[model samples]
Target: MLLKKSLNIVMFLFILHFIIPTTTGYTHSTLEKTHPVDREKVTESPSTIELWFEDPVVLHADSITLLANNGSKIELNQTNVDAGDKTHIITSIPEELPSGKYKVNINVIALDGFVIQEKIGFEVIKEKATQKKEEKLKIVKYSPDDGEIVTGSPQKLNLWFNQPAEITAIGLFDNLQQPIFLSEPMVNTEDPNHIIVEIGEELSKGTYQVTWYAHPVGADINEPDILDVFYFAVDEFTPIQQLNKGEPTNPFWFKSAGLKQLGYWVVFIGISLLFGGTFLVSIIARQSDSKKWFRITSILLLVVIIGEAIILILQKQELENLSLRQFLSVKFVWIPILQIVLITFGLIYSKIRLFFFGVTLLLIPFITGHASYPRYGGYLTILVSALHLFAASIWIGGLFGLITLPKKEEMKEWLNDVIPKYSRWALISTTVLIATGIFMTYSYIPSFSTGSFVKSEWGKAILIKSVLTLMVIILGYLQRKTIKRLTSKAFSTIIRRSRVEMIYGLLILLFASLLVVSTPSAAEQGVYPISKQDQDRELNVNFSPLYPGLNVLTMEFGTKDIEKVEVTLSMPPNYNVTYNAFKVKDNVFKITGNLLHAAGTMAMQVKVIETNGEAEVFDYRIVIPGEMRLNE
Candidate 1:
């Protein structure tokens, strides 16, 4: 039955995948290609600027501007959508441009509300323009001209222009190309045309880029805007004095996706056995003395659930680059705490009370999960999730209760009678589970059936999970059939099939848990910020690509006011420690050394101090990538 059903499922998915609409119309809405191409160097100036998008674009605010090497704009008289093609945005250049490096900047808002920005560089060589001595209103000179390297940190940046200009905003980007948190640009009041931006913080040795937009101070509102971009490098600055590839101090938790995944598996089983088992035994009476299952199993299961909750939270916090204090403030942390208490009571005192409490326990996942969002049907999704969770738990837990029951003459009579009844319960539970699963898929997955199942990781997982679930149902049905025969040989078959069914059930829970971490296909494309919950004054920290390499660290502090912050990172092979983080802006900081040199449960500590003497301390675990790579 299992093989037959699995094949049927495979066929269904085959049809689903092939007959589905390609994502070509939805996800591929970014740059197809750009005019002059990225990093192109040209000898001739193009008469018009153009941009091509992969999909139909709904235009919002759009800008296509040309800029000189210095911070000054060259007028492109008019810009509009190409009459012949909507995909291309065209801008008309006024006259032949002078010989100088120029940058083209384009910013377009897609119909889906996603902002796409692109910049390309090219040089024109036919004619040379007069120097600053001439009366052209434009930038004459600037430092860090196109990929120039700096020997040491520069004191300040200087911009000279033919016309006096007022600064608007200036931005600095790091190696990862994220803008450094910065204050607004400061212009020279004494020299209206010249702007002097102070380098408040000394930059670590690395390649960086600066981009800015400004306009002639008193020009008409319709005049073209000045946009400029340039690269600068801090020559050979290594924050760490030395390297020790010989040994790593931290353990696997420093970057442990494996640890988190393991936590998910354990939590699922614990929930199944504790709540599901409790619910099972509450109504199913013992006959000929209950199968001699150990009473200590409840205690062990309780420990597993509580411990997994802790491990899961820590893993989530680390992956998000957030400190524990910040995580504690999130509404999510409370669910686990309440679960620990209720599950503790349920396990210690096995009664019908536990069955009711188990139902309440389902709410924890509901609140913490993505379904709680209003867009996914909010409370409606929560109710459906509750039904889905409770039913599956009872079904799986009942099977576990049977499997663990001692195979003596004692349970023979009781097991035989209960098997048929439990089978009926399992049927109902599986129905609810599958139905809710479909609803959730539709809620989060756009054009779910119309699009290829492989289009998104979420889709692939859902597809695989559905197939596995169908196979589990097949096994469950076969086990139910065996129970009806009730012969000695048929009983043996029941055990075998139930064990297989249980395994698949656990696997289904795994798939569901993983889907929580995934961004649904319908949730718009590209990396969406991990939705965080904040219920109090909490300090939240996050780091990206939590790997053995350099990564960006960000922090959001609760109760903001006038203050300074300090952050540090320590890496050890064995007591060899070093601090490698520098302040970027306000609460944000970046790591500059071999931060995660170990593959064990490495912990990084963060400290926040206010202008006064008050301070808050937080520590987070980040396992180096060995078993699993997180922080992606």
Candidate 2:
């Protein structure tokens, strides 16, 4: 009878999974390559715009259009697919484009009839100085010189230009294209020609590349800019190659990274079911026949083993070219293997000591999680996280056990007996879960500002998990209230609510898996904005990064009849430049330039000219954030 009831429950869940719709699995052909790649700066404008796709695409006369930063469309010749490679599409520019920012808009139809529309932004920089060849700037020397491998992560990067120059912009990227933390550049006071920047944190073992732009101290506006690039490695060196940008069809699930996340979710659910089922069978439902429950949970343990194996394989794939011995030595590699070994043993010794065995298994994941690597209170954090996971297993696993209970005539008596016992355990588990969860949140997120917390992927995952947890809590409360009065009508309702609670409980685990893969410091750059109104006209300006580097200034006006907008920036101790704000859309203007060369209060003068001949000038003062670690 127990076997038949458990089989029925499994069949019900199987049917429910299919009843709900799954996302489309049809993969769309993506853009694989681009000429003058996105955001690349070229010394000379190319005669053609080339785009290569993963599959052939059908192009129309208006399939490709080039637009300047000011929103003016540039003329282009006919679009054609390369006969040599059907996947390659090319279009020509009729005339040379002036030095400015431009975007290539593609609206081609892929072979699968999916419309692929995207914009690739790039910049054209033509040197205008007629100075002699000897006067051209050059890099005299630099530490961690190109192709040099250091013993460990370098603390600082130094550059010596032939002449004194100020760094306008700098970027340091690892082989995986992830940016490393860097402080704002500083010119050595004693030696004006030398510049240095602090590497905020020690980098992991990987090859790195640095690109920087500098302007000669006394050079005119038209003088050619100085650009230098170099590559180095820490501990080891490897050839660099671009990574693919393929993504999954559904954006909401895993943000283009689905395979590993799917594995993690499966492992989490499997652990919860096995742990919770063991607890219920041993402690709460001992009088009932538990052989069928043990068999069902044993199968879940196998599933858990498979999930861990898959995760291990994926981790190996991420760190390529590792020998089996070297791979086994990594903590990330061995932890899953250890779990698999312990679970296999548990499956073998099931009827004797599986409940106590699960207690040991529940503590393994925290060894590689956030708690193990916190900045402060290391061991305490690991303990808190372990308790949190243990508590979650009790609540979530108990919920699963409740939903699978047979609906026979003795069900009411069974509920009366088991509900009170499980309720006490769940109540205590809830307290532990909430307390540890609060501590984990406070430890993981470094800042609560809009840029650091709200805009980060880690924060988003926490919020989604919190919402699912809240829903489960409400369902648990409903169950607690229903237990006081177990009417016949309320019996079916309670069962339905328990099943829904289990579903939400599983979703919380899914988000927990997401949080595991996310980086706490992956936050968006800051944006500062100001809004003002004079008479009937309103003006809003937004400045991004708020640091001394390449900055974008965006503005919005009250009316759409504006003819032109001009902005002049003035900073004391010698800095003044004017830039024209181009119309990006209706009543919105934007400009991108290397402004705010130094950290100080900057004065901005905005002059707006309307089509009706009315003119208005506004003055505003803004403070730029001091030297900061970009990654922070």
Candidate 3:
């Protein structure tokens, strides 16, 4: 009883060691903010307001609005965030923002769900109208080159504005007057005035107009300038056609490709062993007396070498359309060929030297070139992968070979000898397999901790692979242990356990497929800004259908700019609404319309977008649980 208890403790410790090592240093969110600032104080009527952040913040021009002291909101239609400096500079601050104490309110959101609301109050002093408008105010250029051919499939449309115009007010329009959807235009930080717009995907052939409006910093809240428009065209051209017609059909043999490749390797290896075994039996049969096993083995080796050469030729042809010479050049092919040549000489001429020469030739390519780079984890990976392949070939290919061969005492003796040799190699191979697998997981996947593994797709996949690998290791151990206790009855047990090990190995291979498909962890994708503050002053809300649910929905008033924002849904009693709050980006909160479960058009109300615990109210109504959709 004591022994059994000790064994259980040992097993538990082993399991704990395996599980604990794989669960370290994981994080759920990859986003991180780089810069911190108390606030911004503006002194002059600067053309743009620049705020710096430690990491990149997603800037949506339509979502940004500047509020003046007179209770008026200035719309910043197009704002571009500088990619290089981690700064957001509003282009074209409203020219009419009259001298007054003004607050810059910004609602910024990052791609990874971080929201930021930044409020920087600056004083805009009144300037005398008598002072001639400074020539430093560069002219806004809005003309494309004359005679430039507009192609229907042009990759992008270029807009050159004179002087650096604050880019926050530029918008592109399609032929139908609808806004053309485009990702934020990238500006040359070195030349802050130059901006390039990249068209998304393919554009239809037609004329497109890009308009610019000016939103100067500290400008009067009521006044905004409408800048000139630029036009470009995509001329008619030959339509690109698909090379292949019809809906895509899956390859008929796709499912069988892996099985077919495996079968080919098995058959090729089996033939070599078959001829070798036959030759051995023939020599043994000829022996009238003495333990003539050695002579039979020697003959079998020669026959096997010849069979291997034939198999090599067939394998080469099956791989691709290659010249016989080129196929022979491949190291895997050449190794067998050299082995055959040397072994043939050894058998006919009684020259053991040739066998050694062949072995040397086989080791050449395995040691050089890209295969030996230490930074790539070097010789270790090669050794592990080779061992894995070899063990697989022996266990899978050898079994098939044994079942197909004719029964003979010499053949049986050879099989028994090879199995014992293979079992020892299998143990080493399994060790290498586990070690290399762990190295790869830690190297490629980030933080294997419980949090990361649960939150990230890549980590989850690696966790699954690790679990499967452990199962394979356990099965392999059982097989090895069963071999030590071998008896007449143990043969069936060993075979069954070996089969289980093979199945586990296959599962590991399947996990490999999934690992390749998953995205890299957050650390690899680089850091972005994330906000933790609950109240953000720069909350902005836009609802569709103008009115929602029966409740008097009021968009309460609050600061125009904030780092993060949250909205609370409030409704009169007897009405039920279910809502989901999503941080769309760094400073964007998308409070979805509530779904009313009750039968009546329930009156639902939401206070104004809240920033930093402050709120503004905007009231609207809709039929409860109506089919109306709201897009922000």
Candidate 4:
């Protein structure tokens, strides 16, 4: 009883040690960096104030507001992220921003869902008429001789401005009747006025527009400013030939798949031989051999199954689409079930049947998953999953078998019998694992090159996993050879080798965990595709309820054209309604009203009528909980 309690405690500690939380601190590396935009002095009557960071930041445009010394709030026309680097650029100025001290209050949320608040103050000085007259207009020049057709897509579109223009906007679009939006453009630091728009992928032969617009420093427009546009064409273009094929962009993560496959096979085959041999040896010994060997094999198999189950569960969670149902539906599941059934029948009846049944059952999952896929034109997924399960069972289960076997001569005969039988199975399993791994690498990542593998995150991860797998294989070889000796002196050495292999197995597990979290390649985050969505219309409105009401409401909308809009706020039966409409912009409107004695869920109706007499109505409900914060 004491020994059992002690063993339980050790198992509990192992579980606790493996389950640490993975949250870490966020550092302000990009935000704190000094850039050219930051070094510019606070100019009197500056056209635009730009903030730059080292990395791209997720900004909440709605939350950002600029407050002046006066009561008036500055209106922002546009907020855009610079594609070249980590820069947030806001364009447009207040209609009549008077010369005074102004504060820019920026509340931004990053990509990782962390909120950051920043406030900066700058002085706006009154400019003399002479200073405005002295300001010179900047001219820009485009490379490729403006009309030259290159053989292949140019890496960059170079633009040279006569003078440094405060580049308000710049982007490229494919020349389709409808505009094909390009990825966000990044600014080139090599040349300030000269910007390089990077074309990361191959471009088809077509005419393209290289549009650029910039506002001169210290320029304020009473009317709308004119934007500059340029056109370029790519004809007879050829794509770059890929040098490194079948290499993962991030080697570390990519190689992990292979390493895991190798490790699983080694462990699976090792365990199978050990137990099968032991059972055979036990039966051949005197009937009074006590059948202690069979009990040991059962316990070892259980331990291995449990350990493998934990690893598989963790993996299933990490790989987005992987599921237990999917895994169980495959051939691997059948193999184990068969093995268990065969072992049960053998234990109850004949030892020879037990050996044959166990061997056949063990081979099913591996062969079905690995061999029957392409060559046999069977269910590929089932085959792969079966292979995975077989490898894990053998490797992990085999170690348990080695550790628990008794040192008696009867046990030696069992070991000798099990070891040779397993060797044949192990060799077959290892070969199948390697072949499948190679096939997967080629099929999944055609663009994988040697350079990409070394340089990219995925490649590096795959390399790490591969190295670990090799170590596991080496340890496996040693364990297999040592167990075959079956002498008293050899027992201790074999036990130690098995322990070392187990350590390597655990390390492989850790690498698998890391591989799952990282981006699959330099260009992509594992399986997640990167894309951008454009907003057609945006509206923001804030309203305070006049009555002792449960909820306060706000509504806002903005579009390209102006149209008539109607808003209604429903009040309680006893309360009177007063509505006022205020024009924020030509197309923007705000309605403010109060609801007296409003309770529960309040319904609000909004209607908009365009010039064509088409009306759109929207209904909204605001729920007020029992508790109310009067201060808010």
Candidate 5:
């Protein structure tokens, strides 16, 4: 019993000590990616300028500006959010721009109510007067539109152009770059500018791409043909699946998270021992000596109070990117710090009042957690969370007190009485836990759809925690059955099962930690659009599932035996994350993670180091999708 209890306490403190410096921090909305890209050069003027962000941005009249090289503001159409992809804010150029360097400046409010300002610059190359005049020859419309996900295969491919154009060549391809048969292009009967081609065979359930070459009907033969490409999916399988190839994103939370969960676990266990032991002693086992256990519980509470202070300080420092001294100066930071100090004094000076007043301090986590900022039932959720915490502490702490009881012959009589009384309390606590758990789940999740529960990180965490809780309940049931027998053998069995139950309890706390950090599905409205692709003659880069969570990035270098590859990804002003890509096969390198912070736009820089120590750098700007409306 001594060894088992000591090990549990050591494990609790060990996790608390390590995670004190890295609890979940503040979440500020940020830019994800942008169109035109920063410092890009294009051969022709773009029809529209677009921006993507990790969170929704509030748009206004002066939200966007197009400034020429000499600081002249170019007129633009009224900016609006993209209906299909809420995270995208777009505005038209109205008229074609002349060849020059231009800057797009934007100022918008992020979801977290912070004003974000950013500038994207690109150069437009001058085209010949004749070529500019012939720009009307471009394709105006197409079937299975670019990046569209369709239900089934269509019979023929169609294209519409603003000007009469002769199709030179047409090709179709699947995700694997395998060619699909296409009939020779023929002109539509009603419109000379429209071209049509029959599909040689029915398409399968996968993403498909169409490439066509065309030129103006009455143009010079020496002029180059116009090349165009578009993609559509037969079903839901998108290009993101191609890049990831069914591999799960790197589990960052499992790798380096759960600090807060462990911190709370320690606090929960500490309070449970202090108060649960009191309940057991005063009500169930008044004649049994428990001073030694009470002493351990008092010392553990002191440690927990100190740990809470350290976690608060570290969390504030990381959230604002501030130094310890700078964080200390923040007035609001002191409120929690002072609260903790008073809780410590209460623990030391007055045990009776401490049981009531100091215990209330533990409820602070419930107040600051999801309850405080729920999407619905705000105050009701907070109250439910408090009840949930109170019940859980009693159940877990009471179990601990039972398992650590002295097992001498004289103590057997006391054990028999104590076990039955504690069992009743455990049953009541467990019932409250289940009811509150269901209420909180309904309070947080907007929808109960299978997709809503299975798709989001927040949903997954809740599911895992629920499963663990069920397991603990099963163990409790067995222990309850064994208590009715009340033999020495049954007592040993109950004690052993109780230890396993506590371990499960700890795991439940860990998933609870994950839930605290994960954004609820209702909150993350970012949509998965087409994969962002950038390539040159020598290198190709693909970033997929361009939302905030679980992303896969692939890089292919043409025929190079690369020694190493490193990528630095950033969203200007605030967010930056770097990862080293591992060679998946040959010259193809891959890195996957919850890399993109939010839905918007992101800039990525890749450095490829050759075997001879020579390095080549590549840059790309990509967009991610999020909720359309301004976040509350």
Candidate 6:
């Protein structure tokens, strides 16, 4: 049954890899903000344009272009960045122009040379015209969108604006301004914002324009009426017909995914054996063979820890863009350092030192892990996560020690005292492990639920770990049952079962290691949250990793379609940064930025503009956290 459980886990993982082998790779650093802003409306022509990106910019390889809707180009001429800040890019907009919309194209590179292209649109409208037509009332729909090429003759066209406005006249015309016949336009009394125009008959294939004049509600009557024009063309073919068809898909198996799985297994067994074997040796001094067994366990544990750390370090370096020097110097290096220290003291001096080194050895995974990161809980969760690691190590590591217990002629005499004491300690460690695991899970994944848990990689890992844990517990129960009815013939059978139980325990550790590498859904949701007093509207906002550095901000609206969002973080005395949040999914906007440079409280103001033109501002006192580390 224990072997069956391990086989089940392996099968599940095999199917998951073939079906869903983690499509999400490292996303390139995003361009955070622009001076005029993407799709912004400005009052007057600006002399300069600026851009802010999340990562350091590669200036020598970057380019920017400004183009008019009529195919004319506006020369930006020169580009520059602030000497002190590589994230800020600047350029000059030389000539001011008539009311029109322009597109700014940029090709940018990160320090590591990852390149991305973006096109931004900003409209230049006269101050008076802008006031008469509120920005939210701007046209959002069309008879056909601006650049669409339709195939079939269209008998009717529809347009929907963001809000209701007073309508005046409607005109239909060909490309040459030649008039076309159309029935009187219809506007639904219940939904006046949507306008529909019915063509009397289908016309020949050509370009056509729909023009209308209207005044927005709640505007001054003396203000000039607004004019809007939209165009669509009937072309030879639809784009869907021109698509390059491909054959059916095949299964994908990544070499990297396979290697990651391998790392997970090694680290799991390494921690368990290194700590468990130490605890086992401290209890047993009955036979001469016990000392030889302890020495063997020590050597094997040392090899596993060193090999595991190297594998994980290589994995991190390959997946990230950090320099080789930076990668080598990261917190992961502490693992091998601590391992060497523990082995030196524990082995040469005496076996008694193994007990101290054994407990401290578990700290390697705890120190560099995201679960115990300082931002989550000051010093509390870190301590709890460390305790959790230690408890699990004692429980599973001891199982490995049980496997090495004298299995031949000397086994019957040794098993009498060693089995019962180890069992009691294993029970105690198991209880602590479960309790701490639950506490830490609540601390980090507060949004935990069956639905949310299934959505995240972290949640999936936890689920698998729980399953393997159940298998180990069941095997422990059977081991106790075998011990209770032990006979002369059953000694070898009991040893075989205990060894299988050790394998099951190692499998639990495997899932736990995978969990360490995955990002929790809670963390992925956002970063440091703004203060409660700052919220003018009752919207739930949560940000992940509320530290002094880069973070992702997440906002959830109950039933509102957030039309626009503007966030400003004020690192008082000198720095003030603004960001435009973009929608990632349903009712959620994710904005990534560096909120501050030091540990202290900062002020953040979020202004949300809803689709109905309603706006609200929320003020928050952000507690900027510093990276907390465990003492060496």
Native-to-model Cα distance after best TM-score fit, residue 181 in candidate 4, in Å: 29
After superposition, the stretches of candidate 5 with alpha carbons farther than 4 Å from their true spots are 1-261, 278-294, 320-339, 349-351, 354-362, 365-368, 404-413, 446-464, 485-497, 519-632
Candidate 3 TM-score, C-alpha based: 0.30
Candidate 6 whole-model C-alpha lDDT, 0 to 1: 0.60
In model 6, the runs with Cα more than 4 Å from the true position are: 1-261, 284-291, 298-302, 309-328, 366-368, 407-409, 485-490, 522-530, 534-632
What's the lDDT for candidate 2? 0.67
C-alpha lDDT values of all predictions = 0.58, 0.67, 0.41, 0.45, 0.65, 0.60
TM-score winner between 1 and 6, please give it.
6
- Model with the higher lDDT, candidate 2 or 4: 2
The model with the greatest lDDT is 2
Better of 1 and 5 by TM-score: 5
Give per-residue CA lDDT, model 1, range 512-596, as digits (tens): 6546544454222111222232223366566553444544455666554425444545432122232323434455444443345
Tell me which of candidates 3 and 6 scores higher on lDDT.
6
Error of 1 at 402 (Å): 1.6
Ranking by TM-score: 5, 6, 2, 1, 4, 3
Q: What is the lDDT of residue 339 in candidate 6?
A: 60
Candidate 4 C-alpha lDDT tens digits along 458-553: 445557767877776776677667766677677667666655655555555444333332323231111111122112224443434322332233
Which portions of model 1 show Cα errors greater than 4 Å? 1-258, 286-296, 299-303, 306-329, 356-360, 449-452, 522-632
Poorest 10 consecutive residues by lDDT, candidate 5: 522-531
Total clashes for model 3: 62
lDDT of candidate 6 over 1-632, digit per residue (tens): 55466567756764654454432212233465787877777878877778876555544322577888887888885778778887788998777767888888776543322234567788888755546654645566775654345777788878777777766777776645567888776776778788787888776665565678877667687978877655566662111111343633422332123444444456556655766666675754233325665577567656666555655555454434445554445444445556656655666556465565665565654444444443346368767777777778777767666666556665666457677677777777878878887887767655434644654455666777777777777877877776776666566666677667666676676566555544443223223345445444556676544544444577777655677777777652334665556554557665543434454445678788889899878777554332110000
